[model samples]
Target: MQGVPYLRLLGLVVALTVVTSVIMLIPDWNGEQASTAAPKIDQLLDVAIILSSFVFSVVMVMLGYSIHRWRARPGDESDGAPLHGNTRLEIAWTAIPTAIVLILAAYSWIVLDDMEATASNAMPVEVTGQQYAWSFEYPDENIQADELHVVKDRQVAVEMRALDVLHSFWVPEWRVKRDAVPGAPGSGIDDDFVVTPDRAGTFTLVCTELCGLGHATMRAPVVVHETQAEFDRWAAEQEPIPPEQPQPAAASSA
Candidate 1:
């Protein structure tokens, strides 16, 4: 029957989609889930991968079948039967894809809202980006250091600013990135974002934007302390060393 071939094609599409989706999800595409937002971000990415794989499988299968089924035989130059487009099929495809897009858009919006939600007790950390280095300041502790340090399980609100040109603050494990502009509008130049590190480890922070000649060397270390006490100790250690006082020449010429 005519329906048999269509059903077989549908089955093939479904099978290939599943196989490809699993393959896409299986590898360690993301390095590690260090931040609280990692799980939600990963889930959203997985959904995207599944949808994309399904669409790809459907398109490829249909194209392959059409080519194989309608190819001209050797020495056959006669014109094929004339056919018109199916209005119902066209409407179905258009409506289905539009619906899918709307649903995904809604879902993505919700996820972004949740990820960017602010915390009441988030610690404020000032971030400064220069041509070849980064500096982090803990305003509450009055500590300034080249390395970023924060306590685990606490949300850190990073207020970022760029000293020279445009730069982007990115920590791959945190699953969030924001731009640091020099002189934009009201507070837009000083962008801020909250990140909660769930695990205690060191992560790499890099500037994604092409700043200048030393762009490749523009990287810093982010250390997530295991406890508040540990972070406090580290902050205390960062206190500035007192300037050595002049000894008055120690009774010159005694």
Candidate 2:
């Protein structure tokens, strides 16, 4: 009788697990990647989350079922089944959970190591965050601006910083978001990344941090150009077009 209950519980767990695991393949709504490296990382995380959801669902369902099936019936208020726990059941549960933990831990470590390892020697770009705006600094060109421009397939490392309050640089399409904190070193709050744009176009970089009252107004554009030459031309031409001298208002009515 005990074995039958355990089997039923296990079956319920498996069913719920499978259903939730399958749901993991669905795409995330806020996903983006500014570089090829980050998107792959995001995808891996999504997969892991799905797998975890499956496991979680299984555990939850089994727990719920056990509560319902083994609860004291209306007629029985006295002692239930004798307190003789199954050694095999206890060991199986412990061993299986230990094995899962070890496997997941190893997998997570490997993924982290791989992500941090450097890859292609793509050019780097410095992304600076301030109170109410973002500035993209090109290390090679010695220029900074309110907009960021990069070749579609090139690697870009955003060296981030906050002049005042904390700000998070987030680009949905590139799936890259990192905090820009005050007074850090090296890359500071900067996060290294790379992006290969499957489609070339302009995208918005919205500040994910709440710096101040004008936090909602802080935003920038990332222009992904088709070729390096095009990007160079655009970059060369980004100098401010001086504002025309102010003229007096047109003659008022006589």
Candidate 3:
């Protein structure tokens, strides 16, 4: 009967929806998402994508079947059946997409606002970029060095500046990546978020933007100190080089 195909289609759609949702229910937190409020945002976006995929798949399937099953047989092409429009169906489809888009846009703006608000109180750390090297400057201690040092449970706001050319500051583990532009207003500047280091170890800071021939070597290390004392000791070690070993005074006298 005609109803049988409709029933079957509904059953298939329901089955597919349930299966996909169940699969996405599993949470994977590498580290960055574990600390920030990004997990909720991620879940919302995932739902949107899943809904889109479901709709796209269903439409494609229906279109393919119509093209094949409803094709004219032999020479019986008598201008198919009369075409008709469904006003209610058109309104429903259009309104649903518009509502989803509006909701997503509002949610995204709220999240961005939260991030910028929290940035004001973050601890400042200056990040300097150059050919095959990256140095971190702690204005609080008047120290500058090639390696980055940070204490646990502290919020760090990095101000990145490029020495030679354009580059990008990227740290995958922290879910932070910003371009280190050259000469542009607000150029050579960016920030990142690292609330806590549950796992103490080194992470790579790569130059995302292509600078030059040594671009591959333009990488740095981000070290998360175990304690504030350790960080202080490291900071002291990087103090400006003392006046080159006081050269022996020439034997003047005579």
Estimate, for each residue in 1-254, the C-alpha lDDT of model 2 and write its tens digit: 44566666667777777777667656564455555556566756766676677579766976787797788878887987587777987897798768777877787777666655554766678777877999876767656667988888766656776667798887787765778876533534344544445447899899998899989999998888989899888878765423452323542223
Candidate 3 structure quality by residue, lDDT tens digits, 87-126: 8768977987788678778877876565445544455787
Per-candidate TM-scores read: 0.87, 0.76, 0.71
List runs of model 1 lying over 4 Å from the truth.
1-4, 80-84, 184-190, 239-254
Give me candidate 3's TM-score against the actual structure.
0.71
Q: Pick the winner on lDDT between candidates 1 and 2.
A: 1
* Every candidate's lDDT: 0.85, 0.71, 0.65
Pick the lDDT winner.
1
Query: What is the per-residue lDDT of model 1 for residues 18-108, given as tens digits with 9 covering 90 to 100?
Result: 9999999998787798999999889989998998898889898988988988889999999988778779779978987888788889989
List candidate 3 stretches off by more than 4 Å: 1-11, 21-45, 74-90, 119-121, 184-199, 241-254
Error of 2 at 60 (Å): 2.9
- Residue 24 lDDT in candidate 1: 94
Cα distance off (Å), candidate 1, residue 191:
1.7
Model 3 clash pairs? none
Better of 1 and 3 by lDDT: 1
